[model samples]
Target: MTRSAGLSEAAVTSLLAGDSVALEGEHELTHRFTTELLTTHRISDTTYNHALQALGRDEVIDPVHVIAMYAAQAAMLNAFDIPAPETNLPA
Candidate 1:
């Protein structure tokens, strides 16, 4: 997706490898947000401020919404013990 969106190969590789130090601007903020959100289920005040500074209020809200929606979906699947559908993509 990053490549398709015109991000450089190096940037995409660095991101996939979880190397936030190699990323800049919005990418760096997003990486930090996702890491903290998935691990702690909360964003630090510092991270929130940085995101606000870098992305403004509207943009900052987007990731939070996405995370919440994904978490809800995962919870529902887990609650029902839903089997994941087969995919052609490699594991």
Candidate 2:
């Protein structure tokens, strides 16, 4: 899906490897925001202000929406005891 959305292979690999801060293709601010948001459930005021300065309100909102939506989907899957799909990525 990320690839389909225009993420390069290296970027996808970096993201999967948890190198969000120095992603290969993603914008630094966006990836930083994503990492902080996912790990902490909130971004610090510093990060938020930096994101706001680098990306407009809409860009910041978009990632939040995507993260929330994915979290909700995961919760739903867990609630239903659905097995996660296997990935075809390399080991």
Candidate 3:
């Protein structure tokens, strides 16, 4: 399914940049997509990889953090049955 009206900035950034960031797309859509592609945690996508590569130095982090974070957050929203708003998306 395409981005309904209420796609998040993160989702827009991903499609436009050809990468996923900030957990874009409709909450359920984004979460489901992530679950499918990242079920095993060996995703090779550049955008997702960026999270891991930014470890130590100025900002230390684990790549899995991004996915893990999104998963928890997305699940919470899903649990609440919060629907996305309309974005007036183009055809």
Pick the TM-score winner: 2
lDDT for predicted candidate 1 compared with the true structure: 0.82
Stretches off by above 4 angstroms in model 3 are: 1-37, 41-61
Reference-based TM-score of each model:
0.72, 0.75, 0.34
Q: For candidate 3, lDDT tens digit of each residue in 1-91?
A: 3346467666766656655554533343334435545676554455344433533323323324666787788889899998877775543
lDDT scores of the candidates, listed in order: 0.82, 0.80, 0.53
- Measured by lDDT, the strongest candidate is 1
Candidate 1 lDDT tens digits, 1-91 = 6667566767876766757566777777787888899889889999999999888999989888988998899899999999888965322
Ranking by lDDT: 1, 2, 3
All predictions: root-mean-square deviation over Cα? 2.7, 2.4, 9.4
Off by over 4 Å in 1: 4-6, 10-22, 88-91
How would the candidate models be sorted by TM-score, starting from the highest?
2, 1, 3
Model 3: per-residue Cα lDDT at residue 54: 36
Predicted structure 3, TM vs. truth: 0.34
